[model samples]
Target: MARPVWSGALTFGLVTLPVQMFTATESHTVHFHQLQRGTSDRVRNKRVNERTGDEVPLDEIVKGFDAGDEYVVVEPGELEDIAPGRSKALEITGFVDLEQVEPIFFDKTYYLGPKGKEYAKVYALMEKAMAHTGKAGIATFVMRNHQYLVAVKAEAGLLTLHTLHWADEIRDPRKEIGDLPAEAAVTDRELKMAEQLVETLSIDWKPEEFHDTFQEQVAKLIEAKRTGETVEKAEPPAASTNVVDLMEALRASVDRAKSPKDRRGQKAGGAAKTAARSTARSKRPSKASSFDSLTKAELYERATEAGIPGRSSMSREDLIEALRGARGRRRADAS
Candidate 1:
């Protein structure tokens, strides 16, 4: 059971729905300790006064904001009183179509669920309205000490609050992405080829298909070091750099993605070939497996029928081998 981090009522006209905020993400990074290079002595950070260059006691420490090199000491009680969310309420102004929102503005997400039994109907109504219309609520909310531009979105039958970035926070890529050479001209053939490549690579959203492979590999490498094992690291894939010939690169990528490994578990009889496909296990054996590929379930049944005790407890690999032997014996008896 998750405890609510915050409980608040959203105000849209006269409609008010009691909602609670819950953290959307959980960090799973293994905790590590800093230690001396030679000895295993743990190292610790010390609190020191930067202006005086002296170590300060825990009780003596105070926070101060530098105003033009002059320090303005901030009192804890005063800051808490001025904190935006002292009231702990979210006031929604109105909703807008999701298409109007920029992807760059999205920052952090929090799950919002009904606070009490009385709020359930209103919450559901709001969720359904947004989901049906493909719209998101533009809300103003404060959490901790910061006022946020928030978007209330319906996801998986519940309302989710995504804190958005202010316009000033986004850097204008146009600053670096300047004009190309005046003489640079794209032919109609080139444009057509580019469009075709884009169409081939276009995909539907499937969040589970994407992961932080670099992070996973780093974790594996750390585990290897911990277990006193050495493993060869795979070389990084080649990157495309010639923007002038981007269509050429995309053409190559599209061709490569059509290969056996890339086409696995995908239905190729439609448009949007790159759209993520769910790899559902087939009840019938795939052609790639032994004797027209037997499923683990079928193999286990075969093993049991052959008087292999505890076949149900056997692993998939064991079942496959056992079932193969059983089938071989049956074939031998027929001869």
Candidate 2:
């Protein structure tokens, strides 16, 4: 079990329950340590005195706030003495409909669990009540020397505390983005086609379906370097079409959505010729493996089934090579 980062009392009205806070989410990004470019020596950062150009010890360090011509130095104990004592309790000020809380205000989330068996009953009662009403409790509590605006909501019989940004923190996009586009006209036919394309590609929301592709590529690059393998750079994507080709681009996009990798020969009079070529290729049957004819999407599916690592970010050619290696290994295992 994961350790709780905080312990406190959850208070509202006459109810008080001992609760512990555990982080609800964690990042999976690969991190690297700083090292010298040509050597194995580790690179480190140090605190130094700017005036004397000397390294400073941790005990000698003091935080200061810039005040015009000079800085006001403050001691750690002085700050702690003034820190709010409300950190020991999460006190709910009021309840509001969950829909009122926009996603932009939400920051870090933590799961609030009952601290002891005796508090479990009250904890569950509050959780079920909030879930049933579809409401969240608005609260303010200090944690780690900072007071946070939070929304306490119930998720699967557990209370979740989401830190929220202050109202002033959310900037007005209209002012920052400047020059909003004038309302443009869209044709009925184009609208229908766009909606149809969206419907064709829509699927049930599954968080697991998405992943960090760039991070996976970075990991693959590091592993390749460690194993002395040659890493091929991917070709850059083509620039987007100009405004004149909007209709044609939309049509092509719809076709690509309808058939993920089969939009190459989709012109008005090309179907017959495409069919003839396919028929001839089917009859000729080259000595090479059928995998060569598969599209990148198809190759990725096969690589996934074969349990090839780093398949998520592999190019079409790299996927083909990995699949070929997997086939060889399977044959050796069978032999």
Candidate 3:
């Protein structure tokens, strides 16, 4: 079970409900420790005094702000003293239509649950009410000595709190971004073609079908290095479409999207040609050279043809090994 990060009372219009907050998301990215060059020793950071060149203790460290000439120092205990009641309470100012809140304002999310089983009814009632009305409660609270603007909404039969950026934190894109094109830059014909392309490529949202291919490649690279093997480098990015060929590019993209089977057939044809070449070369008494010359995609195609289980998850080397094992099994059956 996950432990709650905070426990507090949620107040709204004279009603108080005890609740707990838990982080809603976690990261899975691979992490590496900093090390000294040409050595396995780990590199670490420490707070040190500039003039004396001595390592500073945590208890002695205080927050400082640079003024004109000197520094203004503040103690950590002073911050807590000022936020006396905010740490223990989450007060909802008002409810607003959920759709009114722009996605740009949202930051982190946390799950809000009843502090005890006794307060389950109140929690459920709030969640159901907000879910039905399509409203979110705008709230403010202090956590870890930082104040956060937040929105509490009902999601998947539970209340979720999302931290929001303060109004001043948002930047004006017009002032921040340069060289943005005007609407008049696009021709009517190009706009229609672009719309058509979008329509042709539209599909229902299915997040499960997508994954982090870059992370998968990183894992494969690590495994390959550990096993003293080389992993294939990724293909280079395609050249940018020229403005003169914009219409032609849009037309070609629409045509390709309209006929997905044609694209699949092209890939299948390439794989079939590779297989045929391999078979023809096998009779020349050079069997070892056949699979080694094929690319990873070609090997994957052959694995697919052989109906190898778990081939989709296999690396290029794994696919080659599996294909070899399959070929040997077939030869044994034939004999």
Candidate 4:
């Protein structure tokens, strides 16, 4: 089991439950080391005194506040002395309906687990109560020397903590973004078509359906470089032109979304299958775009649906080829 990132007691009024927090999500972004171009030498960063041009040791570093024509140097120890006490507890200040909280206020999320078997009953009670009432416990706590505002809600029989930005942290969009259109009237026909287009494309939320295509491409590029293979560049997608007619765009979108897939037969002749494939690509009816435009996960799903053998071990290119082959077979059989 993974170790908990934070362990603290959660308290509200007279009730207290010892719990541990674990990060609920993780990023899969590819990281690259800084290096000189065309060379293997790594570039390193150092903290140096601007005036003296000398490297500074970690122990010698001190934060300073800029005052008028001077500075107020402060030591790490001084900051620690005045820092918010780490009480090792998430003290709930209030309980409010979850709907009252805006999504923009939420930041990171953590899974809350009972610290021990003895605490499970109390934890379950709190979780059930919150879930039943559709309320979240708003709390403030200090962790890693930083104070955070968080909302605790029950989900899937477990407590989930969502850290939120303080009220002052959110910027007013009107102040930051200038000259926003106040209103643009839409014709009833256009509105109806747009709503229909939305309805046609909407699907139940399935996070597994999405994948980070850019990261997969980066991994593929790295693998190609390691194997001394030539990397092929994909053509950029055509830039979208401004929509002259809202109704026309909405109608086209709805049509594309509703288009049925072409059925070629598994036993069809090679020439017939090739023509079918060409026709399919030409239509590009919302789903027949090239492999480059799709995520690795999307390609994997296609491979799975096609019943491609050994797809689990295949690379992106291999998956694409396997899917194409499967489509050809299906087309031939249908014919």
Candidate 5:
């Protein structure tokens, strides 16, 4: 069995429990090696001294900090002497409501449990208290010679540790993001129609429902190439691709959502699509004009079906104008 990464005491006031920490999550990413194009030679990197451009000898290196132009090198015993016992003690300073910590602050989590029989009662007490109060203990501990801000929480009838970020680690998102329009300018009728459209499209959050289509395609292409199949090189994805129109995009999304994968059961694909669309104007609709061909009356009816805001008060012209304009804007601005 693998040895625990950390062994410590979970102490708050008079109570203390000896515990061991083990990793909670495992990763399954495929790893790759840098190989020569024509030969099977593998590539590797070495630490080189910047000034001399020579490989640095690891044994000779010492931990150091530069203050202005001067350097302060420390011995192996120095760090442990200056700050110790943090490794052997997960000192809980305080407890706060779990909701106070946002998802962003957490880095990684690990499991913590009693190290031996003597600590079982104390371990159980702390875990039960955290679970009952729905609070997490704000604590600090050392692991692999590095200090971490840790949160002790109850998980599956046991205590779990989550490493947290230091104050300077998190960046404020407002720095990169501009303010967005919180309220729509559309009438109640248009809003109601949009709501109905949303209802028709809504689904539970099943992560497996979606897959990275590009990645899956790439994997398929690679498999074919490996099996000696002749294949054309795929085009690279464009950076900042051109946008699709709003009404068309939304309509496409709705159609895809409602259409049965087994084509036999589809009811709306026949005459209704023709009534909403004008196929007679041109044998082939230039992509941009198809959205425009949908009459103001069709747009309003669709919006009404979608449950857009103030549907009863808005005229047919108003509803069509609003839906088309909003959908177009949405398509253009979509990332």
Candidate 6:
């Protein structure tokens, strides 16, 4: 079981529900320690007194603010003592429609659960009420001596607390971005073509189907280096669309998006297989013909049927090669 990061009382109106907050997400990115070049020695950081040229113990450290001529030091305990509600209370000021909160303001998320089994009913009631009304409770609480503006939202039968950035923290993009296009005129034909392209490429949001390919490549690079093997370089980014041929590019994009292969890639379950099969049937010259004519989706279905290993991660060319190898081995066994 995961440990809760915080234990507090949630307050709204006359009700008080004891809850525990657990971190909702964690990073899986590969991390590396700093090392000196041409040596295996790890480069570590240490806190040292500048004037004395000696290491300083953590206990001796204090938060300091420079006030032009001098430094104002503050103790850790002093901040905790001054924290709102002594950092134990999460009080909801009001509830608002979830859509009213801009996505830009949201930050980290924490799963909020009933602290004790006895408080389950109260927790469920609050979650269900908020979920039914599509509302989020706007709250303020102090945690780890820092006050946070948060939204308590109901998600999948549980409450989730999202920390938010204060209004002053958000930068004005209009002031920051100098090259933003100012009301550029878009031709009606180009707009229609672009809309058509979007419609053809639109897909239902299935987060599971997407992944961090760059991270995967990074892992592959590490493994390849360890094993003295070569890793394939990733494809270069696409060239910027030519302004002179905007309509032509849009039309071509729409055509490509409408292709059965691209359409099948977006679909899932039986629909994907059906589309792949249909494409194969329409494109395949003969049963004995080469797999070059088949799309990656069709090759993947064939690979799945054959139980070829690593088919999920393989490219279209890789799939075709694997399928051919599988067929050759099957023929050899039969003979």
Error of 1 at 114 (Å): 1.7
Question: 127-240, model 6: which lDDT tens digit per residue?
Answer: 999999999999999988789999999999899999999999999998999998889999899899889877865666656655555677778889999999998674464689
Worst 10 residues of 6 by lDDT: 255-264
Instruction: Give all candidate RMSDs, comma-separated.
Output: 11.0, 5.6, 7.2, 7.2, 12.7, 7.4
Which candidate comes out best when scored by lDDT? 6
Give TM-scores for every candidate, taking all chains together and pairing residue i with residue i. Answer: 0.68, 0.78, 0.78, 0.78, 0.64, 0.80
TM-score of 6: 0.80
Q: Candidate 5: deviation at residue 122, Å? A: 2.9
For 1-335, candidate 1 gives per-residue lDDT tens digits of 79987788877788888888999998766567999999999999988788988999987766789898799997756666876656476877788889899899998899998888888899999899889999898877666556789999999999999999998989877675687345677778677877766675455665654455455666777988999997546435456658776765655455433434445754564454333222222343543467425655556444533555445445555566766777778889999
Across 122-210, the per-residue lDDT of candidate 2 in tens digits comes to: 99999999999999999887777677899999987789999999999999887887787667788897788778768855656656655
Per model, state how many residue pairs clash. Answer: 0, 0, 0, 12, 19, 0
TM-score of 4: 0.78
Could you give candidate 3's per-residue lDDT for residues 50-155 as a string of tens digits?
9999999999999988997999998988887787475888999999999899999999999999999999999999999999999999999988899889999999
| Model 5 lDDT per residue over 1-335, tens place | 55777887888888878888889977544356899899889999988888999998988777888987999998756666655574688888999999999999999999997898877888888888889999999988766667899899998999999999998889876675678445646656445655756987565565543434445455556788889886445435335522344444555445533433422355555685655534532443343554446654445445644445554344444466667766777789995
Highest TM-score, which number? 6
User: Can you list the residue pairs that collide in candidate 1?
Assistant: none
lDDT for position 60 in model 2: 92
Task: lDDT for model 5, please.
Answer: 0.70
lDDT of 6 at 254: 60
The lDDT of model 4 is 0.79
Clashing pairs in 6: none
lDDT of 6 at 121: 95
